[model samples]
Target: MSDVPPPWLPEDIDETFDPLEHADIEPSPETPLIVTPRGGDREVGRSCYQVDTQHGRYLVDCGLSQGTSDKFPDLRGLQPQSIDAVFLTHAHVDHCGGLPVLENRNLLADNAPVVTTPPTASIASLMLEDSLKIHRRETDGSSAVQQFTSRDVAEVCDRFHTVGYGGGRIEGVAPVSDVEPAIFQLGNTAHLLGSAWVVIQTSGYRVCFSGDLGGRATHLPDMSPPPESGLLMLESTYGDTHSHPSLSGARTGLWEDIERAIQTREPVLIPTFAIGRAQTILLIIAERLHTLSADLRDRVEIVLDGMAVEGTDIYHEYVEDTNYFAESLVNRVVESGETEPFFAESFTIPETDQDRQKILTRAARDGTVPVIISPSGMLTGGNSPRYLAEFTARFGNASVFLTGYQAANTTGRTLQSQYQADQETVSATIDATPFSTDWPESSDVQWVHAENTGDSELKTRISFSADWISLVEGLSGHAAQSGLLSFARTVAPDTIGLIHGPDYAQERLGPHLAENVAGVDQVTRSRRMTPIAVGSETDVDTAVISPEEIDSTGYTELEDQIDHLYELLSKLNEEVASARNEPGLSEAEIREVIQDEMEIKE
Candidate 1:
């Protein structure tokens, strides 16, 4: 991504590290390519795709859609039992959250080999375990039978077949049952630590799946050079438009906000995703702190909250093995075995209420300012809500910096919209627990009033006299419109299928791909269940690609398993009702028996 290594990078590593050039990749060409997008078409989540050939059936990235009702991929017409393998791109929940559920429910082949980079395997373990814990707490047993348990996630991790990027090493070519042998290789996409663009050779053709390609380098890895493919399935998360602040501009904007907060002795609050975004923020602050004045540095403190602490630890864990991190920083942490080497310079990770109160009290003192980084980047949940309630409403002593995208329906988006409203007219539910719990108005505290200047949309910064809020860009993991187009042109696939983006993104990227890639037979934007047959000259739009025509033994098996589970549960419920109605058993006796049974099960 850069010809010259930044000053922060170690001198030992090569500036031009192209992982693709030396890859010993070999592609086999077959015919009758069939692709059915199970999810992540015309939307940004639940990104699963089914690719079928005479050789095998493959499921790519079984993710969950984050929404009012979270959705898993539509495996309606395919049998999970027939799936030869599961290939994961990265560990982002939206891209890989459904794996444990699928495998646990027998929707996937029994202990099917899951292939991904090593770092991704670790990250996915953390995310999956965290998700199940959080889900159980949130639902409080109100939901139906669990799809997967923590034990199931542990099993999934044990079954992961790890692979490394570059050097053309094809992993998992062994045939699963009668399925034809297939080979897959991973290349760094630079989207996240272990993120990669997969190239699978099967069915006599090479298929490339761009699993969230990153357009530019941040503190993480750089995008690998494009690999040749007969059929290309690309992500269009940022394909609709290319206009956004440059990484440098974003950094400058954040720095200005921090400087202002420092001068005013006000605290700064940054809401970010714990995984990628928070790590980037920490790297930025750690690198820049050396340039600050001694007095300012002593007076300022940086705090991490939520999953960011664990995510940052994982970042350091991979420092020695991955090129994405600076070697100097990695060596320091590695040598000292410090969970957070950056914390040596006034950084805090509050564990209890007392710790938080102490930090808040210290920040309230004159000449001392604290910068807080919290999670659930969208502000829909996590510690960010608490921080936002405390900081954003204040005038003259604080600022909020949104460092990434704010998807619709999220609190982050609501805050952004309110910031753009003409007056303090846009009301929102902050849902923060006030510092003084005994306050009489605490129960009624949901609405927050902030004077909006209504100019946030015109630019990144919104000023309201002494207080402000800014939207900083260049933190997005997806490639820009031109970047996606250029990547497609470089790959120059015979057929292209777009997914993992909104309708607007797909609509814009499809034409751009068709125009840019010469001799392209078709560039189709896929919706759920839409099949784009590879090596077929027929126009995809007019083609009748029915679900029945596709060999979906995998989805069929999944359906049967689900039906069986439901039948079993229904029978148990009926039995329980019959027992309750039995003449010999009193109501009290029945209740006691059911409670005893539940305890026994537990």
Candidate 2:
């Protein structure tokens, strides 16, 4: 629960400066809404935007881009003190990674709390703390010193005001002497844990911000639709193309790859992100294995390592207790007679050094293929590299399957490209080694085994050439072209401001939006840090229509159907209660009756 005031009425606001109700003071003239992109306009990373109106100045996001010399958002020529509020959509580094920098500079106003969902508040804290550790290691002696401390992350947590999606409105920035107070509401974007689509409303204007929107439902909830507004700020991560495979297809493909690896006794390495991607992969593996051959399924071991283990735990906690999912989905989970999905049967959470040693040793020695899913998907850092080094050398019985995007110039991308080149005996050398002797500059340290600890200083090497498979299915978090267009139609805003995409993506989407998307007057392809005029025609009807008002009958019918199902289930439960008194009734009979009543067949 956050201490921030819920939707403040005119009376609840400051008595000294009531912009809405003071008859004596004339309302401030509507200023042309100025949007300045400090980062993430034309580029794909470091997303930070400043939305300045006559009433308030708000920051949608502040983040750092990976694989760039200038990672942090450009904060020059901007006064952080002037900004009223910071709203974070999700916990991903590209969206919320630059918070520590802002905090370090004391840029945020004291009253302006970092506003976001509860899950995001928790996950962001974890991400920021982890980022701090990573930054400290990389920037130890470099000119780019680590900016914020662990204490800064703690302070961030303290300042977070957790609000649920589609809940009561939370006041963003307090109304100043003349500026009107901006009110904000969050809705699920289905991108990751606690990802949200935001709508901000002030007098005479409304704007919607789509922060990393997802199209289809995953293990998590489906994306909530953004309300129609005068101005829509949308993400175009995959707007250029619509070639992503379906979730079912991606799962089946990955399962087939794993099955082939198992048949050949080849160790399969699944490099993935610690959060959503890793958890989704685990569930997919667990569910798909029921159809697999008994021998192959029994032989496979799913080893969970690195930060993914922590992320999975967090996911389970929220999914079980909170409104993190749709009401219908939550009801289904409860009615299905299972509290949690069956994942523990195959997944292994190794705790100690000895436990990890057993997994690695068994993977190398046995005929059974171990599917090792490790973190740091890009191969820039984490346990995935260690596993890649260990297994990639054995070309005959090893495979590295990438399950996400590989950023350019990253070690993951390099490996992906090298594998595609069909070069024999490909070598990957790591600089750091356990042994501390000064080796010659020309010598490559070859790490034979993780446990092999001799006086010899050798670089970690992958001598054998193994072809790496890049699986894009179920990999990306952003919505594809079809999904984007669907969202655009649902919102039907007057103007669209596109950001968070490459040049080609925006180019393709801009034309599509102009011709096909109705009610859109203009589709602007945003560049870095350029102020665009929006909400100029404030009189235009841009207010979002309530769905209840339009489709009350359809909504009622759906509710009636759900109620009917519950009634049938309840009757089945009553039968079971009565059957308990009879000795002849069996468990199979009870289940059969329940399924029959529910119109389900095995």
Candidate 3:
């Protein structure tokens, strides 16, 4: 091979040219808006994006990753003191969990405010406090260092600048001299109690961020249409899925599962996300409680536990706020004269260990069919695992329903996989409290409390039959592929960057948008640590600096063809494996079958 520089490189560039040496250059008013994906580029958790405009630097969301070692956003190259503001979209831990870490690491400026909606601020207070407790507990006897303290969480909350939906000029952000100030607006996304999509205008450019879009929830108002923008950064969490089962159908399915469990006199345990899913499930059951026979309704017990109790309280506090809720909910609250919209007639809150124990004992001995709702939906933390251990070890016919997305490596995902594979039993190692007293000798459960340590590390192993496991679908808070395409068309931006999804999903959605959505000149799947620059008149420029990172947008036409070949080969391999089980199937037959499948997928 001839020793020559690639034609794409600048003619003056040589080995002596260093990119890092010029990294300290300050951005000027003429510089294009630069967006760096610190996290949530090709993954679903820790959704943090760093945007640099001529006016200032800002973050869309700083969150923690669930069920992974890389928990916090990659903030290595960022200058903490230079951040002008942080815009939070909602109160989900994956979206807002890392705020305290910014405070702890001094990554945020002293005067920079965290701007969000009022309901988000209220719900985040409870979410952050509960998150701190989990953080302390998880790091107690490990080499992993604690990220933040309760004091740091309090400091982050103190900096919250509450803004309502619609347009407003952001104050307190550092501005460059002789430049226009940044303006912002929040649009209701109906993903959660106060989730929103944010549009920020600065330096003669408007950028829109779809911070976890969803519009199917009936309790929240319909999603507001986002204004047109020069560039749109959209979330692709469910981009591979064409559509979701209707909400009403999913609710009916869940109710049928619960109804079957009740008739069998079995205790039902539902592990749900504390903020949104928990409240939704509670309301679903409450609305149907009166339909059951009077005796059955009187005998059933609905127990709410963990952080969900506090989250539901915050929901009630905002019941009258039109910006946070839909008209149907407010009217129901007013017409029924009920202070708590989520509470059922048999609602019970377990305040202490004894209270929880009594509920468990009654279900075990008296055959009381208590329906339990708890937090930490992934079964990674909170009282859900503890309750799971107790129910698995004590009751033979108990039902455990997983509600919402179960991230990789979580106990919920493990159980789900085992059940899908038709396994006889599911086993998981969980953290729980040791029993206060010994159970009957016939039980398989065992526990020994350490003499000197607190109750944090006392309890241990649990095993359950797969027959008790059920996964309730169609409860996600993210939009599917069709919704994402619609949102993109509404904005009708020149460029679209897909973030907060897996590589496979982004791969499928990118081409769909390029082919279906008009006026979109470029569709790029965000890669972490890469900078994508957007300018007014110039084509979108993606700077590929790291050798290990894959350029999602093929740099040349030949590269695009090679990437497509690899994708087809991967699909063929999967088809071969699946066909191996078919008896007497010829290789040619298998190839024909695979070709048909590929045609349908395309």
Candidate 4:
């Protein structure tokens, strides 16, 4: 195994080939895109977003949710049988977790288009198989059932259309939901390697849905915004104030922290986000360890805890597939000693539980020393939590190093808590915030938007041969602030819908958008499972009027209505408190109810 390279990257390389054009599905304008509930709703946790259009409605993400089925309804009451496709954004569970569920149910059987980046298709299947093992263990053979099986995942993969950054067009499927489809493209959003901003020109609306956008860009690839846009569905993750600060001080700070943690001889646990962030840290670890002596390097063992290692394998496999993903820096981990930034040994596990338990037992030993890198970055759920439980109290010298952004309500956020896990309870400080709820809130949920670069071409590639300098000091992803302004100015849509983030950031950004910023229109965000009237210029006098039924407060949850066993919109908005006042419906019913509720929102 050590002598051979990953089969995906054999010597017969095809660097000039583009994997995205594998299939060129075209579309027509008559299709109307419909949004469905895949996950990510008002309740928090889990990320599922679906888009349905005439070209044949499909999904964007199918994240596993934390809240009750009553709370996170399927959103689209569409009969599971009717749904046509599922587009995976990245391998993260929040984005791809729900996919297995769709497969197990055999929803859309053979018909649903499983669209994704080549890398995403491979990595997601690997991650899901791992997740199934965890679920099986946690649920302990409960007959309740699981979301997906490896075979089902394979089935979906068989149907996948590999679309690379701006490769253009969904294979066989049209861009419009209900209508004939035409060419469309994917832009690199850079949140994760395969994360994208899907661009489609349907009817008259040229929309670009921002997948998670990373803060800055260097080795990572990102989606370039369309040349012109009628509607820009931008992400607001960083819609608030600036998300990541200047890279200027980030690296220096990271080194100082790492040095401090290592000096104690305690194992420093770096909880890494599985996707791009994990790879970034790996290279950073490789480069920084170069300055340390052999003595120090031997003591600093690096463990791959989260899905990142597996993800890295996928990224490395696809390295030849994309110009943007590079792994030479990380390949040096084993030889790192004497060379300065040497890590004792970096491990990519056997993808088995006994192996995991072995790693944990070793981490808890008396003389074992090192740094472990694991995924499930948010800590909502992942191998990192188990590691945290074993090593948190063992050594005062030991520090849990958070290497990625901590999302809200996740375990990663708990790191910031003054509390340590005490027995079954967390020992929060006297001044600490008390959460009587079953789980703690996520602390690392910070934000950063990659600035738009206004760069695009069918066959364009950038040359980057920079050394792996300090990582904390690096920030690049979203269009630069200037890029955003320029994109806004050029499109100058009569009105642009600035959605995806906190309300105020959108408000502030809206005003800051220069007047010349092309047809910039009204800025709106769908913070809740609710809707606001969408008005058109010609109909300005009447326009699309908001439903008089809106509660204004916006926390409305419509009671489930069954129309011939199909869920449909209802007039009465039930208080969430009454979410399950009625019996929790079966998965089939929830799927329908979710669809019904969203229709009313539109």
Candidate 5:
């Protein structure tokens, strides 16, 4: 939230917020208080939150993740017309990328005055258009699912309205218009160029939503959580202390690993987010190779897959609120390019088919002394997979390096599967909640190694799931988590609902006032389907919240649905067992595992 008032805000501060402020907003304990996390829970990124009161409704960040394609918030599901307004926190694809897709959707009403600060609005437009372009390129001319194209994104600009760090306005409409009702205050979270931590104020309640807490005082500004809040929806990206590694430590470790891989004369593969991490990794690599140690220099061959060079520009434009590392990273890529003709003036960008082929050919060679960098940070869907298929064939002494938070069910997560070579074939359904237990064993992962084609040694790479990277970055950008907690504690809400991060992160986040987040009380959450929890007893449709009670109102029904599958599979397994040596593993044995997992579900 900046000092300037958005066109949507009312001129009268104490007078009252717009009624449209709470469109489609759910009910909350604070006369008008309502908090609903649309995405980023029990998973990572694509975060959206709704704050509503009987008076009005307003949304804080409306982005998407893999799950966004699911029924509710996708272009098809959301009634954009009903949304009163939208507040953007930052420009990260996960946090702000989904807005444009809203245009493609059919809406109940059709106007949410997509409100955001100037910087965030400008940058998100550009980043989202780029994302749409890439998505279309990959989708074979079909309607790219869950992606917004440049034209669609351009349409979004018309909806673009401005807000400052303090408070902006979107005037017109009654305090209790047809739109849901609520009041929201947003301030810079400093997580990125224009990130913001949201504050929801209702007639009788107050809640502070910690969008995505940034890290400690890194190169960027440190954010502190508000001192008190009736309800605190904080992101525990770094909830566990284990995630507390200094950036310097990560930098040092990354260098050691890269140097070792290069020594064997193999390419070092790093799959990173085009938004931020990709450049950060390169700068660190350059610093380690050039300025830090001379031995680290020559062996390092840097190669890029796509428009990562352009992404550096996006980060550069927002340098004021961004960290020194990100700002300097743009400059670093330029200097590194100037180091030699291949990268410097003669930059061999992969625009045409032939260019892409060359980039791949060079990076795939055994003696090809280069560090190949690509976008699709989590390796979910990008050129990274193509390289893996090509280079790993020969067992080159190479490795794949991952440096972003991988969303569930994505190709990024699939890479961790143990059995692989030219192709991957394994799928085990996972329980999304209760974090620690869900992390598949390290053995299940296929380690990166060099494929040797006679004398040529092509190296695959290692992976890094920077789980705490968000938490740490969020802390520094928002007020420190401590400051935010103060605001939550003060609000003293009767019911607190948590959303917008992996379940592990929320599970790890203790209540700002020492209570457990999922430990009963009035709250609602979902992994795949819907689970609604209510505090007050008056509502007929809502379930009552009891202390120490873990709400699972629909758990039984969902379990039954899952059970049905297990039962069929079990029967199939028995029949398949009749065939002693069958292709694709005994159907019966596969059934057994499903049956066993089903039992565990109960």
Candidate 6:
């Protein structure tokens, strides 16, 4: 055999070499900070990043992916015992779902604490518990191995070290013994209640991790500006879009739709994320309840179901905390002596299957439109699907409003596709345990009773005639292209790495930032498992891949240009065809217009 050793092996090693034996390890000030994206690279879910510094190794976020093959972060080369701490930005599932997995796999070090804001810790507990239930239900009869257990979730929560926003220098979190700890600060991101963007200064390097920035939500304060850094890892979830629909306009449209549904006596089902979106929707409805006609307002009943009940309770728990909520919410809800800012006068929280059934039955019987808001925004889990199935089976004419991003392969995405296509009927198979009832033999729903199958749950296929299936825009927690560019400009980092977005979005955002943002020497679409080194004095390694160099030279730019040209051509063709149908348009005039357009293109 050759004398060369594997890359993983130590140089000049012999068989007698003890793995634990080592020379004195000293902190090197010149060591460049190495950031390796373990997840949330070129995709939206499972946001994780491994940072290796001179002082210690740390993780920015440990999260799980939904509706994708790779549900967990790439933990192949990660040693759980080596991680000093986990910096969680918020309580969203995609940003905190994998903490339990870390514990389950024995990856988390015994002394390593999960550092986050207090609001994040509280909401994350609820989110993790719900996630565990879904995980257990999904893996009930299958051979798929469970990623984590309830005990693991509890352990993860117990390890959380709550810190307030703008808190400088995290205490009791040193990466290496006897070395100076990293100085970090959390700024309000305005994405979720406790969301914050983390800026860490360690080993002579300042790195900023933009953990899901947001400024669109009216219930939360504007996102705080992050301090300048040498390296900025920013989320690009909406990088391909210029801007969102006006929040006021979206709210107006939603209220108008709800009013129309109420006027027609059709129940409206709104499937929303339990944490942020549900609370926002509730606030919107509550604020406008008085504006509705007295007769219509008296007939409208708001129903909050499933995990949203607990999620709202958590929101109320922190209602007075100015660090988490906006001044308007705190003043109007807490200072004004309002019992609850997120609930209408005629709101109901169904605690059991019987209550849920009664709500639907009463609504159908009395023809009083009930606006039902439930969790599992994607309709992938929770009681939303059960409600959806029951609604489809019970109501002939009803409205379903989807308020957030619906990932691919989800029932929400399926319904959204049908809605966009204006299909007369929408159909999908959903997993749920129906309320105790006996369906007629000629029912349209293909029901599989849990008792008949000896399982705890049933999967049923239900179809419904189109009745106002709407995808409400401007409710997203993520900032669009303009906001991202603005944030980048404010930070003005030398290098930027885009994460927590799809390939197309990152591809569009990477070059856009490089072209627009000044002082950005490099802009890259973060790739999972790739190591990017950032340091002031050190030369960037050749391993760092720029967005422009993702494919062949100038490929991304050319593709963007080609897409623009095609759009222009399509518009020109439409104009020419419309002119041809006009009474006075001639072939010569069309030729002139086409020639002028061609010259402009040249």
Number of the top candidate by lDDT?
6
Winner by lDDT between candidate 6 and candidate 1: 6
Worst 10-residue lDDT window, candidate 6 = 18-27
List, residue by residue over 1-602, the lDDT tens digit for candidate 2. 01122122232433233221222222234534555666777677778887766656678888887663437876654554666678888888888888877777677777767789988888888788778878777677667766677877777667777888874443433324443555687988878878898787766566778888874444556577777777778899887765354444465568778878888888888888988788778866765566668888778887888888877777766765445754443554577655555253666877664675567667666766788888889877777876665454333558778888888866677777776787654565554332123221222235443325554545465555545455455556777766676677777977787889987998777766655567777777665544554555333222223222232222232232333343334334433432342222333454466566667666
Q: Candidate 2 — what's its lDDT?
A: 0.65
**Runs off by more than 4 Å, candidate 4:** 1-55, 66-73, 104-109, 133-152, 167-179, 215-217, 326-368, 378-380, 407-409, 419-517, 527-602
TM-score, structure 6 vs. true = 0.83
TM values, all candidates: 0.76, 0.77, 0.83, 0.63, 0.62, 0.83
Candidate 4 lDDT over residue span 1-602, tens digit each: 01122132234423232111111111223324333233353223355554544545456666664421211224333444554656665666656666666666655635667677877778777766776665665455454445556686667657666766654444455233433453466666556667766665545555555555552433453335555655554554444343244332344466566766666655666666666667766655654565677766655666765466667777666554343442332323223323222222344453665665455446556445656677655444566655544443333335655555554545445444323322232321111111121112232111123225343312111111111111232333343333344445544544444444444555445544423243454544333222222223211211111223222322111321122122111111111111223322333444456666556443
| Candidate 3 overall lDDT versus native | 0.75
| Candidate 4 CA-lDDT value | 0.47
Per-residue error for 282 in candidate 3, Å, reads 0.8
After TM-score superposition, the amount by which residue 327's alpha carbon in candidate 5 deviates from its true location, in angstroms, is: 11
Clashes (backbone N, CA, C under 3 Å), per candidate, total: 13, 4, 0, 85, 119, 1
lDDT of each: 0.65, 0.65, 0.75, 0.47, 0.48, 0.76
- Model 2 spans with C-alpha error above 4 angstroms: 1-28, 68-70, 167-179, 326-332, 336-342, 352-354, 393-396, 431-459, 468-474, 537-602
Q: Which pairs in model 2 have colliding backbones?
A: 445-458, 445-459, 445-460, 446-459
**How high is the lDDT of residue 547 in model 4?**
22
lDDT of 5: 0.48
Best by TM-score: 6
